[model samples]
Structure formats: C-alpha cells, structure tokens
Target: MRNVILYVNLTLDGHLAGPAGELDWMLFDPEMNIALSGEMRSRVDTILTGRAFHHGIEENFRAQASDPASPAELVDFATWMISTPQVVFSRSLAEVAAPHRLAGEDLAAEVAALKALPGKDMVLFGGVSIVQQFVRAGLVDEYWIKLYPTAIGAGQPLFTEQRTRLELVDSKAWASGILTLRYRPAR
Candidate 1:
C-alpha cells in the first residue's frame, strides 16, 4: 500500500498560516525548491489537499509552469506540480477540472482506496481542517515538515485536533535557517 505523506510548511510556533489564513510570512528558498522537487519526483505520484488550498496551489504552479520569467528550478517544480494528479477533499465543489478531482465524502475510506491503488506515495498538501481530519483519523504515514524561523504569534495550527507521538527519521537545516524534519508515527 502507498504511504500518505503529510508535507507542509510550519512557522517556528507550528502554525500553518497566519491569523487570517494568509501565507505572506512563510519564507521561500530556491534551494529548498530544488530539494522538494527532487523528493516529489522520486516519491510522490499524487497530490492531496483541502478545498481552501487547492485553488492557490493550482493557480500559482500553473502560472509558474508557463511563465518564461520563472526560475529554471521553479519552472521544473511547477511543471511537476501541474502534471501530478490532485485530489481535493471538498463537499461544496461540484467538480474540479482536469488533473484534479473531488474525494468522496468518506475521507478515510477514500484515502484507503487511494492507498490500495498501485502508485508511489501520496502527499497531503493541506489547509488546516483537512490536516486535522487526517491526523484525527490516524491516516498519515509520514510527516515532512519544513519549519521556518519566522513566528506568527497566532494562526491556524497544524495539530490542533490531534495528539500524536512522532519519531524523527531525518532532519536537514539550510543556511537560511529553514529546517526540514521528517517523522513517522511512533510505533
């Protein structure tokens, strides 16, 4: 079965977004982009996200993939992002365009079905509630968290709905102080 990887960026205080769900404070690094792209290329075949994050992710990457002015590394990453299949967990959306689809109402069941399919691991690029739901359901197999040095005092947190014990598997720190930590549920 494929693993469900929760890949996200968090502030120093562990929030995923600012108080208003804004992401302007998150630091962006070109080197991190290359590393992330390489990881995705090798391990991820599907993209999963909640409705709130789907539009921005799609729009940003689509534009980057097509824009001639985008950096080579970003363009490559954007191309991979757009080409990967995305499953959005949403109830109100009637339908999504090509390369994107709405997951069934049964979140756990839908994820189970996806995992049973033959493919590389799946990445959950979340917006708060979706991450909460998956964590509460105990469905995530791995966590890839990029912790930025910045701190937004109050914001949408990544683990507000669940308490999990994780074992760190690997970690890397960049010169910019962006730290990437990989963890798995403690056995």
Candidate 2:
C-alpha cells in the first residue's frame, strides 16, 4: 500500500507557518531543496493540499525561484503536482484545476483506496486543517518533519489537540543542522 508522508519544514519551536502565515523562516538551501525534491518526486504519486499553501508554493516558482536549480526543481514539483492526480480539500471554492476535489465523504477510506493501488506514496501538503482531520481519524501513516533552526512563538502547529498518542519511528540530523524526524501514528 502507498504510504502517506508529510514532508514539511518546521521551526525548532514547532511551527509550520508563523503568525500571519509567514514562512520566511523555512530553510531553502539549494542542496537540501534539491535533495528533498528528489526524494519527494520518487515517493509521491499524488498530492493532497489545502488551498492556502497551494498559492504560496505556486508563488515561489514565480518570484524567489530564480536560480536554475531552484526553478528547475520547482518546475518539476509543480508539474508533478499538476500532472499527477491531485485531490484538494476545500470548503469554499467550487472547483479550480486538475484531478478535481477529493473533499467531502470519508477521506480516510478514499486515501486508503489510493494507497492500495500500485504506485508511489501518497503525500499531503498544506491544509493542516485537513491534515488534522486525517490524523484524528487515524489515517496518517508517516510524518517526515524537517526541523529547521528557528523559533516562532505563534504559528500553525503540526498536530492538533488529539487524544491519542503518536509513535516516533525514527529521526536523522542533516548536515545543515536540520533534524528529520519520522513519525508513525500508533496503531
């Protein structure tokens, strides 16, 4: 079965997006970006995201990703996101782009069906609200957190106030001083 992995960058203080949704503290070194992009390309067959982060990721490709490597990787990531099957969770908009909405109904069952198919891993980006829904539903399989060296008191948190415990499967420290912590929801 395809696994659901969250490849996100967070501060040492554990915030995904800072107050006002600022992500300036995110680590974006070319080396690590390429490495993570390669890894993500190899793993994800589909991406599910919240609309909020989708715009930011899209904007990066337009303005900040000027470097050849960065833009190239961004192109690949964008292409993958656009071309590959995508299911977006939105409560407001009607429809936007490819693959259409995977909103409503039993998302966990839908995710499981996608996983059961022969493919790479299924990934969820942005949309922490939806992510929390999945996490609370006991659907998430793995969490790959790239902990950057920074601290923010207020911002978007990773996990919501869940009643269950999650098991830490593994973790590794990168040369950039970022820690990649791997977590699996306890069964």
Candidate 3:
C-alpha cells in the first residue's frame, strides 16, 4: 500500500498561511527548490489537495512549467507538479481539468483505495480544512513540514483541533533558515 504524506510549509508560529491566506512570507530559493523537487521525485506519485489550493497554487505551478521566462529549476519543478496526478477534494466542485480529479464524498475511503493502488506514494498539500480532515481521520502516514523563519501570528494553524502524536524520523537544516522536519504517527 502507498503512504499518504502531508507535505506542507509552515511559519515558525505554525501558521500555514497569513491571516488573509497570504503565503508571501514563505521563503523559496534555488537550493530549497532543488531539495523539494528531489524529495517529491523520490517519494510521491500522486498529490492530494483541497480544491482551493488546486485552483490557486497548483494552477500557477502548472503555468510556470510552460513559461519560457521561468527559471530552469523552477520550470523543472513545475513540470513535476503538472505531470503528477492529483486528487482534489471538494464538496462543491463538480469537475476539474486534466491531471486532477474531483474526489468523492468519503475522504478516508477514497484515500484508502488510493493507497491500495500500485504507486510510489501520495502527498496531501494543505488548505486547512482538508488537512484537518485527514489528521482527524488519522489517514496521514508521514508529515513533511518545511518550517520557515518568519511567523504569521494570526492565520491558519496546521494542527487545528486534531491531536496526534508524531515521532520524528528525520530533520534537515537549510542555509536559507528553512528547516525540513519529517515525522510519522507514533505507533
């Protein structure tokens, strides 16, 4: 079975986004980009994300893949983002474009079915509510959090109401002050 990894970027204060859903505070450099791409390439084959992020960030990444002016490394990363299959969970969205499918009602069941399929692994990129659902359901197999140096005091918190104990599996510190922490649900 494939693993479901929650890969996200968080502020030092644990906010996924700013008060107004702004992600401008998250730092991204060439090294960080390369590191992220390497991890994604090695671990994930499918991406699970909320509809909001699919429409907002994912679309932008897809566009960046085809842009001639985009940096080479970013373009390569965008290619990976666009090529990977994605399942977008949304109650209101009826349809989505190619490379992405609108998931059914039962999130856990759908995730389970996906895990049963032959694949490298799946990753869930957060938009708050979806991450909360997965956390509450205890569906996530691993957590890959990239912690930024800045703090957004008033914003969407990553943990929310769910409380799950995680055992640290690995950690890496980047020169850009972004810390990558990998964890798994405590057995």
Candidate 4:
C-alpha cells in the first residue's frame, strides 16, 4: 500500500495558520521551492486536502503555471500541483470540478481506498479539521513539517486533543530559519 504523508507548515508555537487563517508568515524561499519541486512533488501522485484549501490551491497553481514571468521552479511545481489528482474531503460540497473529487462523509474509507491503489504515495495538504481526523484515525504514515522561526500567539494548531508519540526520522535546517522535521508515528 502507498504511504499517506502529511506535509504541512507550522509556526514555532505549533500553529498551522494565524487566527484568521493567514499564511503571510511562511517564507517560501528557493530552498522551499526546490523541496516542493524536487522532493515532495516528485514523490506524491495524489494530494488530499480540505475543500476550501483545494479551491485556493487549484486556482493559485493554475494561474502560476500559466504565467510567463513566474520563476521556472515555481512554474514546474505549479504544473504538477494542477495536474495531480486531488481528493477534497467535504460533506457540504455536493459536486466538484475536473481533476478533483469530492470525498463524502466516509473520510477513513476514502483514504483507505486511496492507499490500496498502486501509486507512488499520497500527501495530505490539510486545513486543520481534515488533518485532525486523519491523525486521530492514525492514517498518516509520515509527517513532513516545515517549522518556521516565529510563533503565532493564537491560531489553529497542528495537533489538538490527541496525544501522539512521533519518532524523528530526519531533519534539516535552511538559511531562511525554516526547519524541516520528518517524523513517523512511534510503532
């Protein structure tokens, strides 16, 4: 079965986003771009995300890929981002557009079915609630968290209400003060 990886960015205080869901704090430098294009993008064949995040990402990447003045690395990343199959978990959304599927109420089943498929791997680009559900269900195989230097006093945290023991597999620190920590749930 393909591994289900969670790739997310968080602040020093463990918040995924600000109180208002703002992501202006993240430093998307060349190192990040390289990792996105060379590591994460190359390994994943599918992307799982929440509905709102899906819409934003789809729109943003589609636009970036089409722009002539965009950086080559970003353009490449955008191409993969728009082309890869995306599963958006949402109960309120009845129908969705192409290259994207709406995963109804049964999130765990849907994730299981995806894992059973013969593919490279899958990455979960979350919007809090979905990540919490997957984490609670123990569906995530690995976590690639980009920890920024600054802290958000109050916001949406990465882990909530659940106690999980993770073993650090690898780590790397970039010049931009972003620390990439890779972990797996302790067996």
Candidate 5:
C-alpha cells in the first residue's frame, strides 16, 4: 500500500491560508524549493489536489518550467511538477486535461483505491476542503508541514476543531526560520 502524505505550509499560528485563500506570506526560499523537489522526486510520484488549487499550480509550474530566466533548481523542480501525474478531486469539474485526471466523488474510496495501486507514495496539496476531508477521515498516513515564521492572526486554520494526535518522527530547522516537521498519526 502507498502512503498518503499531507505536505503543506502553515503560519506560526497554524493558518494554511488567509481568509481569501491567499498564500502571499509563504516563504519562497530557494534552498527549500530544491529540497522540496528532491523529496518529491524520491518519495512521491503523484500530486493529489482539489479543484480550487489545480489550475493555479499547473499554470505556475508550466510557466516556471518554460521560463529561461528561472534558476536551474527551480526549472528542474517545475519540470518535475508538470511531468508528474496529478489527480484532482472535484464534484463539479467535468474533466481535466492531460497528465491530470478527475477523481471520483467518494474521496476516501478513491484514495483507498489509489493507495492499493502499485506506485510510489502520493502527496496531497490542499485547498482547505479536500485537506479537511482527508483529515476528518483519518486517511492521511503522514504529515509534512513546513512551518513559516510569521503568524497570521486570522485565517483558515489547518487543524480546524479536530483534536488529532500525531507523533513527531522527524524535523529540520533552517536558518531562514522555516521549520520542516514530519509527523505520523498516533496509532
């Protein structure tokens, strides 16, 4: 079975995004970008996302991959992003283009099926609702949170009201003040 990893960036106060789903405060560290690409290359082969975030992610990466001015590491990472398979979970989207597919409406069932398939682990990039569904269903096997230094007073909280118990398995603190924390759901 494959692992379903929730890889997200959050503020010090735990907000994954602002009230309007703004991620303007996220740290854009080059070193972190390279590390993320490396990790993704080794650990995951699929990108699981919700409809709200799919287009933006695709557009950004596509541009980065084609831009000659982008750094080598970023260009490589962007290339990886566009080449990897993506599964978009949505009830409204009739279809998605190449390298992207529309997932079934039953999120848990779809995930279970995917997990049972022969492949590398899958990473979930959140758009709030989809992340909350996975969290509420207790479907996520691991959490990779890149905690930013800033604290946003008001925004969409990552944990919401759930009292989830997680065991810290690994962590790394960067000089840039960003902390990468890895956790597993306490069994």
Candidate 6:
C-alpha cells in the first residue's frame, strides 16, 4: 500500500500563496530544491495538485511555449512535472492540456483508491483548499513541509476549518533558513 504525503513549500504563516495568489515570499533555496528533487527522484512518485496549481502550471506552460528556444528546457520540466502519473481534482475544469488524468469521482474515495495502486507514496502538492479536503478525510499519511523563514501576517492558511492535531516527526534546518518538517497525525 502506498502512503499519501504532502510535500509542499509553505510560509512561516502557513500560507502557500499570498493574498493575490502569488508565491513571491518563498525563498526557494537550493536545499529545498534538493529535497524536492529527491522526492521526485526517489521518494513519492506521483504528483498531485489542485485546480489552482493546475492553472499555474498551464500559465507557466503558455509562457514557456511562447519562447521558441525554451521548449527544450520546458519539455524537460514538463517531463519531470508529469514524470509520474498526476491526479488533478476539479469540479469546474473539464480537461487539462497534457499528461494529467482526471480523478473523475469523489475526492477522498478517489485518492484513497489511488493510494492502493502500486507505488511508494503519492505526493500531494496542494492549493491549501484541496489539502484541507485531504486532511479532513484523514487520508494523508505523512506531512512534509518546507517552511520558509519569512512570514506573511495575513494571507491564505495551510490548514482549514476542521481542526486536527499533527505530531511532529522531525525537523531540520536547511542552509537557507528553510525548515524541513515531517508530521503524522496526533492520533
């Protein structure tokens, strides 16, 4: 059985995005990138993100495709982004551009079923709102957070309405002041 992990970067204030839906505050250090690379390469295999993040990917692809010489670099990133199968959950979105399969069903049940597939762990890179759903469902087995040094006092929050406890597994300080944390549900 595969585990579901949330390997996403967040701010000290626990907001993955700013009020304007920007990640301008995340310092994006090499250590964090290295960890992400490790996760992509060896750790969790699948990449899961919400509709908002999917929109971001689409916009990035459009921007990258505009430059003719960029496809080489872009195709590489795209290959990595879609390297493992991806599941995007959206009620409003009918179709995605490429390499993304629709969940096409209930969120919790779909993800739970997906976890039963052959894999190490399913990486959940959420849009906070989507993460809340996973958390509420009690389906996430592990939590991996790249906590940035800076904090935005007010913005979107990482966790949501259904309050739950998480027990700290371990915490490491990256070279660039980001904190790599692992947590399991308190229960």
Q: What lDDT would candidate 6 get against the real structure?
A: 0.76
Off by over 4 Å in 3: none
Candidate 1: segments with Cα more than 4 A from true spot:
none
Model 2 stretches astray by more than 4 angstroms = 57-71
Residue 16 shift from truth in candidate 4, angstroms: 0.2
Compared to the true structure, candidate 3 yields what TM-score? 0.93
Question: Model 5, 124: alpha-carbon shift in Å?
Answer: 0.4
Instruction: Give the clashing residue pairs of candidate 5, or none.
Output: none
User: 31-150, model 4: which lDDT tens digit per residue?
Assistant: 765875588877889999998888878789989999999989789888988888888998788887877888867877888888888988999998888988899898999999999998
Per candidate, the number of residue pairs that clash is 0, 0, 0, 0, 0, 0
lDDT of each: 0.89, 0.72, 0.86, 0.87, 0.89, 0.76
- TM-score of every candidate: 0.95, 0.81, 0.93, 0.95, 0.96, 0.83
TM-score (C-alpha, index-matched) for candidate 1: 0.95
For residue 93, give model 2's deviation from the true position in Å. 2.1
- Model 4 weakest lDDT span, ten residues long: 28-37
Q: Higher-TM-score candidate among 5 and 6?
A: 5
Off by over 4 Å in 4: none
lDDT rank, highest first? Answer: 1, 5, 4, 3, 6, 2
Candidate 2 residue lDDT tens string, 35-152: 7778778888777777665655555544544446655667666555556666676777677665545455567767777778898887887766776777677777888788998898
lDDT by residue (tens digit), candidate 1, 71-175: 888898888887888999998899999878999999989999999999999999888889989988899999999999999899988886457899999999998
RMSD of each: 1.2, 2.9, 1.4, 1.2, 1.1, 3.0
**Cα lDDT for residue 114, model 3?**
92
Q: Compared with the true structure, what per-residue lDDT tens digits does model 6 show for residues 132-171?
A: 7788788788888889898887777777777879999989
* Higher-lDDT candidate of 2 and 5: 5
| Residue 132 Cα positional deviation in candidate 6, in Å, after optimal superposition | 2.0
